[model samples]
Target: METDKKDKLIIALIIGIVIVLSHNFVSSQKSDDLVFENISSSLDDKKQTKLINNNDNKEKNEKATIKKIHISGEINKPGVYEINDDYRLEDLVNDAGGLTENADLNKINLALKLEDQMRIIIPNVNDKDNNENNMTSQLISPINQNDNKKVDINTADKSELMTLPNIGEKRADAIVEYRQKNKFNKIEDIKNVSGIGDKYFDAMKDMIVVN
Candidate 1:
């Protein structure tokens, strides 16, 4: 009878040890699962943050590349505008509230790409004949008495600069070089050129403009 009791006691002790080990194993598994879930969640949050940052950076880069342009003449709104560098003349015109009913679209190149500090002039249909005559006369004489168009000193090329009175190739080249670094703020600013002075500027003051 004592032997039987001893065997029973031994069996009970063995069962109790097994139950404790099983409970410990299950708790360890649950802790491991929770740790895995937390690590996965942290990785997902990091990826989302990186994606958001990338989008913000892309937007900033696009804004940085924006170009400022000026549009005028025969338009609903004629003023300075900000646009993307890749935008064409048509896009700018559309943004400026489209052209007027009398706007001469045939004279403007809508496919021209926009540039920073660029100026665009939309012609009036009623002035077509006069504009053509002036263009023909410009080929013969740099300046025409009948033409009221003023040379834009800030945006004129070498040949256009030569149109000014007493401004030969050398002076034209100098004007172009000077304007490349220092844009003309006003008609009087042309006097800042190396060879241009009060006398030279006075001769072309009525014929030139800065925009």
Candidate 2:
């Protein structure tokens, strides 16, 4: 009877150990499953964040590529407009409700590429004096009949300023704005304007004079 009790006790101890090991194995498997799930979730979140950032950057670049231009004179609707960088003068004219009946298309270069902060003036066929004042109109034909005569920096309009070599609309506008606040005492003083450095001044120094 004693031998039977010992065998039964041994069997019971073995059964208890097997049950504990089985429970431990199940807990460890559950822990591993949770770690894998967390890793997958983290990877998914990172991918989503990267995608969103790329989209935002794309949108910002598109906005940066847009150019702002101002159009006035002899147009149905003359105002500042936002246009694509690739837009031409004709495109901007159409955007401003097209040119009026009095607009002289011959004086304007419709194929000219538009630039940021550019001002466009459509000339009127009947207004000869006003057409002379129009920068765009003057650009098509030289206002100064004699090339030998130097341009007066102090009295020169935007179109006259643009007559200088390497001087575009932007630089011409800058020169006009600078002159409004301060007068050029001498021809060298033209360099004081922004974007008109030594090289640019050298190119047009002979063509400009201050009275």
Candidate 3:
């Protein structure tokens, strides 16, 4: 009877040990699975943060960009200059190596605020009066005797300008804006009015006049 009792006790101890080990194994597996999930979530969070930071950087870069302004005529270095949008005309003049000794500072206000796509022309001090006379003369072109072939752009409406070849509504409106700020002294002076270039002027040269 004692031998049977001892066998039962031994079997009971073995079964208890197996049960404890199985419970511990299941708990350990659950802990490892939870750790793997937490690590994956952390990686995803880092990637999202990186993407947000990149977008913020790009936005800052776009806002902080400089503007383009064209500077020509009578400066030591006359060319297209890229400058800060808030910069003044004085700053742009200095950038172009100040001005030539003969430049007529009286003609322009250096304190004028700068804008994109602006063109500045520095006049000569000595010949300024003579140059003024020449400009007036160009504006007074006597119409060609032939059936009024030349279009007087200075007095022409937008519709009249659009009648010329290569001069669409945009170019025609640009002419009006330019003429508002600057009197077209000569028919050729239209070339200096931003969008009108050599090709466009050449295309409409024979068909246009200044008066």
Candidate 4:
């Protein structure tokens, strides 16, 4: 009888041990699965972050490659101007020394796109005596003209020559040089400048009088 009881107790203990081991095994497997899932999620987040950073770097590099622009002409102050790729004409004008006293705002379309090494020429005000020498210069045409005559570029001073449309210090100088070199044969001889085209000549034809 005692042997039977001992055998029964031994069987019960063995069954209890098997149940505990099975439960622990299942719990361990669940823990392993949870750990693996967490690792995968972390890796995915890191990859996304890397991709975003790479895109940002590419954008920055593209912006760095864009070149700046420079401009010069009859501005309040004329000089080399450094402008960003997206900069507008108005912005560039402000950068390269603002408009000069006689700068004709109408002559320049401020909305124009700026190009590299582009020369911007600001025209003198119409019917105005304004010039570089005077920023606050006012428009005042020669009130006293000889009867039935107008001003002559061949003999006009720096200030007087500017009264003609598109005539600036540079053009005025060219006129004087041409007059001295070849001597004025006729008023039409004033077209030797590098920039003076037929259109400009037509505009100034009436304003100029050969002395």
Candidate 5:
């Protein structure tokens, strides 16, 4: 009877050891899984942070390419404007709500590139008493008496060009197409159009202005 009791005790001790070892192995596996999850979350957070920084840099570069300029004199809305750096003087005039009625479009170089903090001055056509420096610097053209009354060939559309003597739809379209490719530098430059000649110009000399 003593031998049987010893055998039973040994078997119970072996079973208890096996149970303890299984519990330890399961706990170790769970701890490893938790560590892997934490590492993956940290990597994801780092990637998100990097993406946000890259976006911020791109926005800053875009803003840097914008130019700030001040436009005044004869403009409808003269003050400050923020625009693209490559914008021209003509674009500036349009941005300032277009030129005033008396603003001279002939003298200034409209294709000039806008720079940061630059001041753009648009002179009036009626400033007849401009100084020698103003004439030399701004290159203001003389205001002809017929300018206000005559049809401006430079700005007139095809319909307005057709109002002239001997000008039909085909002739008017040719004038616009020619002007688009080669701008008229003077009132006499209208003769360069397909249908216009010396005789035609003479008849309409009093009726046209380059302005």
Candidate 6:
């Protein structure tokens, strides 16, 4: 009877140890699942934050970036320049130092869109060859022909005086200085200069006069 009691006591102790170990194992599994869930949530939040930051960066870069344009041909200043996306043709013209005095603004479409390496051509008032020829013809033609034997250097324009053969801006200017200094009495007084001789005076004798 004593042996049977000892066997029962040993079996009860073994069963209590298994129950305690199983309870601890279940609690450990729950704790591990919660830790994994927290780690997964942390990783997801990091991904979302990174995605948002990238989008913000892209927007900022787009706003800060400026496009450069290369323009040439017939502008006042032709070269490479940078302009914002909102800038227009008028703004570009101003940045390029505006147009030349001879530039024909009426012929071009100033409101047209610009592009990279674009050639902005401000055409001449007329066709190139025709314009040049017209200018030459106008230059050769005389204006208000003087019939008397006098030349008024002070009042006459440089172009008018330069119409004489072999006369240039410098020589015309010299004649004006001579007239101013001596207050010419006759047309022969112009012969005092080195380049202007009696022959040159005779050639221009009919073309000039004085009051």
Which candidate number has the best TM-score? 2
- How much is 113 displaced in model 2, in angstroms? 2.2
**Cα error of candidate 5 at position 2, Å:** 11
Best by lDDT: 2
Evaluate all candidate structures by whole-model CA lDDT and list the values in order.
0.74, 0.76, 0.70, 0.63, 0.71, 0.62
TM for every model, in the order presented, reads: 0.55, 0.58, 0.48, 0.39, 0.50, 0.35
Q: What 10-residue stretch in candidate 4 is worst by lDDT?
A: 135-144
Better of 4 and 5 by lDDT: 5
Ranking by lDDT: 2, 1, 5, 3, 4, 6
Q: Give the per-residue lDDT of model 4 (tens digit) for 1-211.
A: 9999999999999999999999999999999999999999999999999999999999999877664443334466655566666767788777766777766775566776665544344555652422444321111122223444566866887777766655666666777777776755566767765446554565466667776
lDDT of 5 at 49: 94
Clashes of each: 0, 0, 0, 4, 0, 2
Residues 1-211 of candidate 6 have per-residue lDDT tens digits of: 9999999999999999999999999999999999999999999999999999999999999867756665444467877788777766678888998877776565555565554433343444543322332332221222233434344654676776676543566667777777677765666676785556554454455556555
- Candidate 1 per-residue lDDT, tens place, 3-61, comes to 99999999999999999999999999999999999999999999999999999999999
Worst 10 residues of 5 by lDDT: 134-143
Tens digit of per-residue lDDT, candidate 2, span 1-211: 9999999999999999999999999999999999999999999999999999999999999988877876766789978899986898889888999989998866778998877766565666764433233445333222232468898989988887877755667778888899999999999998898766564455467788899
Off by over 4 Å in 5: 1-22, 129-211
> Which residue pairs of candidate 1 clash?
none
Deviation from native of the Cα of residue 132 in model 5, angstroms: 10
Winner on TM-score between 2 and 5 is 2
Clashing pairs in 4: 75-100, 76-99, 76-100, 128-139
Report the lDDT tens digits of candidate 3 across residue range 118-167. 55555556632223423322211222335556688899999888676545
CA lDDT, candidate 2, residue 144: 35
Off by over 4 Å in 6: 66-211
RMSD (CA, angstroms), candidate 1: 10.9
42 in model 5: Cα distance from truth in Å?
2.0
Off by over 4 Å in 4: 1-27, 30-38, 45-49, 64-67, 74-87, 94-98, 116-211
In angstroms, give how far residue 206 of model 1 lies from its true place: 18
lDDT of 3 at 2: 100
